[model samples]
Target: MKHPYSPGRVLCALHFTLTVFLLVRGRPKFLWFRPLSPEKLMDAIAQLGVCFLKLAQVLATRADFFPLEYLDKLKTIHDQVSPMNAEEYEKVFARAFPDPSCFSFFDSAPLASASIGQVHEARLQSGERVAVKLRRQGVDRLVEKDIRLLRGILWLAQPLFSRLTRNSLEAVISEFSDMIRRETDMLSECENLEQFRKRFVKSDVTLPEAYRELTSSDALVMSFIDGVRIDDKEAIGAMGIDGEKLISKLVVFYMEQMLIAGFFHADPHPGNLLVQKGGRLALLDFGMVKRLSNATRIAMIEVVKAANERDFELYILACKRLGVVAADAPDDKMTEFAERIFDIFGDARLSASSMRDIAFTTLASMRDLPFKIPQEVVYVMRVSSLIEGLGTTFVDNFNGVKDVLPVLKSNLTRALGAEAGLFPTIGQELAGLPLTMRRAKTVFNDLAEQNLHVKLSRETLDLLEGRIRNMMRPICQGGLFILAAFLVVGMELPWKNEIAVLLFAVGALRIVIGLK
Candidate 1:
């Protein structure tokens, strides 16, 4: 095991601790030594190194938690890093390939550098051009150390912020750790690339083909793609590509990925997407991807369907089913949340800013509520946010609802057809309608007749019986008091006096018991 007292780790821990302390103090201007701002906090995280940088990237997705300015600063956090020198690359390369002659040409300089690793352009002996990605020296150890530090921080702070720590904070860190671990494992990336490449064969999206024999857990080799960055509108225009059409296709591609394919590239930032000559999109970086379960996909479809139909109740139901809201959440709170969400979508054209504002407002409203975000749904939201952000950048006056509704409707139609055929589904429901109506009618009639009965569990029955006894106790005590007074006034016998006394004592006892 590496020593726990590394200088780098100690500096990172101190930097994080101090930055958090300042933020908690909430008096950035009061610092005598230096000016502090949200931007400075972002810089602190960036300087802490790759693990912290990755954390900042995840934090940027949470518009609900952080301010827009902070998010803006963190959003600029990229994978760009100082490239490793030739000697370092050669040493790492030798671990993956025992002999150095497997490649005809290998560039000493890196094509791109990220926090965990760097990619270099290379050509195999067979003359195939490929991108060789190698993990940074000792990145695994660094990440493990950083994660330990972060976990310790979370453990220490959990008691102070119980509400935030109830689930989200720990969950976010755990998910990030899992994601980063997978990302560092190049074999996983190779698998993702191959899967996406196979999945998008019928679509216009291009994925670099992975060379399995040349790939290892520490290194990966894939077909190198040469294309302009998708975000470079001028370059795309120069190539005579229709910008609007390209954006539309991109949106459709993601919609299919989420709704139909049930798997999607979770990260689609401008840097990771490239455009080939025919406007074909070449997707890079498969380290972070999301796969939706069938139930979740259906629930998402239901939400879209409800939104299109302007049915808030159905939308809320869909949310509940999707685990977006608690299963036992109060109807009023869910309705309020759903209405707020609807208000955001009620407008005809929904821009990325409007969506983000809605997210912020919704989160603010739900801050005091028992709303919980499921782990699976977090990735879904991240992917949706990225797609919306990309759309906003690529297209002017982008209407997310307008662009997404048609694809949703199409997918729904296809799903319906595949499940039971649309007409048969309708027929099945129609066939069951009379029995349902009959049952409803019978229940209404029973209620009108005052003969409606509810089945209760033994526990519930005991509770109801206890409540009835309590209600009767008050009336019984009052009756006993009156009886005792009558016996004291109207009867002259010694026995009558004793009976009145006993009656008074019983009433007093009843009162005492009720109080208890």
Candidate 2:
């Protein structure tokens, strides 16, 4: 189907093409085309509309794609933007509130504006103050078109990038597409907020109570938060809040979200977090939430435990299990990589630039390896980087390694799903000892009976299958050509020559595409 707005498609296509061109030119080999300045690049992205702006924010978390200078500039791209125009406000407001008597006092002006939607301050008829988040009218369609446009651009540009870069780009765009689409659905955001509210009841962190009765697909109503942005140092200090203590709380909360509960608010930027009276934290904007499966969460815990213990081999193994490192990745190189990472985390006084340099150096050393960031871990990396950035704002020597590891270590048992005492856990394991021994005996008996055989891992089998299929394609095309030649030379039918020619052309085209 055609885009709902045709002119928007044209504008997005032009700006996206320019943005890609500028980035390509930024490479050292592109001497003919001068790279645009970082400001110019940012302007191009901003002009691409709200979708690309959100994309730029995601890119800010990726240090491998851009240098520190570009990262510095991209970090300034905030979710806050110009509020909706009168036409957009009227359309969304009318759709959100068919009955005008829902709110006794509803402000037409938005309290805050973002890429997906804007929040308005309102008072319910029962005299309760609330904040209503309204999805921008027609934003879902716009986002759909923008995602399609980006995919088209990526398809056109894929040949220009190396395999690793191509895969990374695809993964980033795919993850961002899923996340942005989720953000456009206000009902889903309400559900996410309610889940978080239930989870945070006993914690120091606060979540706005979602009013399900007053919510719909177009809008959500929740209690208004009157708190200071976590990064506003001056205001926080004026309120007699300890900056270090506040950061500690934020880090601990994140640790609980990621490691203990396995459900986290992916966007931890300062603007999405607020500090209420008495140094309490209030998390906002639950549109971009993430959940970790049991296997992933367990592997992540192993990664942290291995890192804290300084076991390079264990760390690399955990990384492989976590799906970040290829299963067949060379142990020596991976060990070296783990060593460098541990060294960076070991130094409390390491500056962000120094850490970046070390990481880049390691990546350069292992450039040939098939390292990848899976979709499941994309937001994990993003949240870590953003939280580290926030911590560095208040403390000079702050890092996630230095701050979060201790918290995770302290909560290890709870994170492992063992809330009860340790002796009961030991007793439970002992109770299963006979069953474990029986399974071991079965494996031994199979070996003794000569029934044991080597089995390839699922990943290895898939890789082999793909390689075999690729190798056979051209062979099959050549066979088709041979059959066509035979038909032309031996067949006596009236249409034999015509069929032979058509078959020959089809075979040649297939072979040519495979070679390309």
Candidate 3:
């Protein structure tokens, strides 16, 4: 089926390629993926370059599902992707920088390389030490193919899989795809870096100052940050630096990132974090940041309270309010899951027992639950692991989980007024009751006086435009199915008319609901 503009075709080709490669794959990587663990596969995919590598990195951020082996292995697939050669660097510099002829002192060699792009150690003609990041030439198209293939694979697997909802998986992938795509636009990333830096102005965490004059859509140049990578444990030890304090700073750093500033470095792995000799963790790569809205921030505030008070139910409720939980989950199922989580949460606070004991007990208790966790839990669980992983490694006998609760508790108490309740909000709304009644009476009076009235404003115009746009999306999609059908039954082409009609129906229903 040679459908014009079908991204699915690229996906089909990739599927075929992977299938053929795996057919000839080493006997080690077979039946239930034993040939290569999920982690090793990620490394191989990273080696393959393009989107697959990026995917492995994102999945590595998600430690909730994969075992510790995969997490440890995939974490090593660092930003060390192959760099573009000198010739390509020159061409890109010429394209991105104006007055390229005047350029006297830019390094042709990359300073660093990740799966998607490489950073070159460069000096401007102005004698500034800058880091130049260049997007790999063919990455965008590869990402497009990779994203399409993932969607196709998920769509095809919907009926066969029971562990996850297709919508849920697709939503997470779409978000990650959006983030990875943002990395392609170096200009946007530069702006993001500046924004994050600005947000963290007073904070100990900092980002490299992006050199706007040397920056462009394809290339980003920032003042070179000089520090040892956080993972350089040997160097850390040699300097006699406090690793536990650094991690403590990170915990507080990330807490402030989301809580106070409402801007967070979504990827805060050991690679992206650098520890200065004085102990400040220099945050790198602001390209994949997440900004929380006021509402989201409030939800997170509640999450802090819940995590501190050992309130799993409130945490679950907060998750639901934040739209982090799927709506289709059964109430009882979620409650039971919450109960099990509470057991873990309570156990996590136990000081008498070791982490391994708590973990073992938690694992044993999980056998009593029927509900599975959503993938987003990985991001949260990763935080827990970071606290524990870095904590145990540096601060012997230090329970990161136990330590975090006190900080969160003390902070929440100081920030949110120890006794603020729903009553205050209700009272505020009640204070506006007179105005609401006046408006209601006015509406009724207008109806009686003029038979009908609809006050119109620019706000109404904006609302109407939003409604129209939503309706148009589904209609435009339906048109494709209609066109496909016309070619099938009308033009006598061998086609899946049934599927086309179904798609049309789905689109029509969506449009109808949009209008409603």
Candidate 4:
């Protein structure tokens, strides 16, 4: 079906096309003209309205997909847009409520405005204070038109940027469009609030209660939360709140959300988080949230475990499992890529700035490597990076790696129960058991026949050591078992067989030690 064209759609297309052109041009050809900067690109996207602004916000989280300069500029794109006039707001509110007197008191001026909606402070007929969030009139039609125009542009440009298209650009846009459409539906935001409230019922974090009776697809009402902005450290201190402790609590809360609950607030920018009295955290804005599937969760845990252990090879493996890297990627290339990642993050304390640097460098280098983060996990990465950013603002010398481990460990224990204690190490060994046994059997048969004269070159030993260093705990355990079995089967003499028995005992001891 053919769609009608609008000025908003035309303007968005023109702006996006020009931005892409300028970005691709890189440098100015004319002597008098200066090259377009990242800031200019950000401004252009912001001008495209809420959808593009939200897109820029999502892009900002992808440290691994974009350059640091672009990321830095994109992160500053605020949701606060021009507010609708009182007359326009009244029309929108009337459409949703159909009763001007539904609220005893309604502010003519919006408390805050964003691309999709504007919020106002109001009092219910029952005298309760609430925030009324109303979608901008005709925003849905505009968004739909713009998205259709965007898809058409992408279709036309698919051949020019086949690589990007191959990377699932269309899929990403579709997901983003779906998300924004949901955002336009205030009911979805209310549901998000309820889910978060339920999830955090026992935690120190607080969420505004949704007024379902007053909510609809276009309008939402929730109990207003009174708190200081979380990033306003001076304000928090003036209120006698320990900013550092609150920051720590914030970190732990997010950790529990992501690692334990597998659900999290996707947009945790400073404005969305507020510090209430007694240093309690008040979370607001549930327009964007993400839920991680079990497989994705496991992949993230594996990546963290590998990074914590400094196992570059295992890190590569985890990335492969996460579909960030192709399964058939050359081992040497994967190793090199992993080495580069470790070099970036290995010694650096885990802070927002450091992570941004790592993501920028790693992604920049990926032009030559086979790497692509899955769309499903993009929000996860974004939320993680956001946490780091918030942490740096809240605490000095904040080490995310140090802080995240205990939370991860505790959540993993709860998730895995008693068996959770044996992880990648034992898991790896069991997975490789059959292959290890086969290799050991061949060695034992050769040795028993007196046909085996083992000789090791320094280079070969070095390679073996490298493999051992990169091996998972389970693989190491299996290697010991293999060695002990080979010794027992290969030895003919009583004394030598006794030594083999001792080796077997030692291997058993190693397994027990690993368990302990």
Which one is best on TM-score? Answer: 2
lDDT (0-100) at residue 252 of candidate 2?
74
Candidate 3 structure, TM-score to reference: 0.68
TM per candidate: 0.73, 0.81, 0.68, 0.72
Q: Tell me how far the alpha carbon of residue 132 in candidate 3 is from the true structure, in angstroms, after superposition.
A: 1.5
- lDDT of the candidates, in the order given: 0.73, 0.79, 0.62, 0.71
- Look at candidate 1 and give me any clashing residue pairs: none
Worst 10 residues of 1 by lDDT: 25-34
Worst 10 residues of 3 by lDDT: 19-28
* Tens digits of per-residue lDDT for model 3, 1-516: 233126655444344334322322223332343335454465456445555555555555443334445556766665565567677656766777767543456666666677667876766677777777777766666677667776666565555333333334555667667777887788889889988777778887657998886677887888888888787888888878888667777777767766666676777667677877777778788677666676666776787787666566776666655545543344566666655545544454454345445554554444322222333333443445545555655655555345665666656642453335678757877899999999999889888889676665322443465467667877777676666655556654455677667666776776677567
Question: What is candidate 2's lDDT per residue for 174-246, written digit by digit as tens?
Answer: 9889998998998899999989988777899878998898888889999998899998999999999998889
How accurate locally is residue 400 in candidate 2, as Cα lDDT from 0 to 100?
63
lDDT (10s digit) by residue, model 1, range 1-516: 234456775655555644443333233533343223566776667667888888777756665555556667767777788987777777788888787698999987888899888988999999999998998877888888788888887776565453422356666778778888888889998998888878878887888889998899889999999899877888999999987778777877887787778898878888788999988989998988778888787888888888778687887777777766555456788777767765665465766577667767676667655454556677777766676666656554355465556555665665433556767878988999999999999999999999999876322443465566667777688677857767686867778867777777777777766667
Better of 1 and 4 by TM-score: 1
The model with the greater TM-score, 1 or 2, is: 2
Query: Which residue runs of candidate 4 sit more than 4 Å off their true CA positions?
Result: 1-36, 162-165, 346-363, 395-411, 415-516
Off by more than 4 A, model 3:
1-36, 61-64, 67-72, 101-104, 238-240, 323-392, 396-400, 413-516
Order the candidate numbers by lDDT, best to worst.
Answer: 2, 1, 4, 3
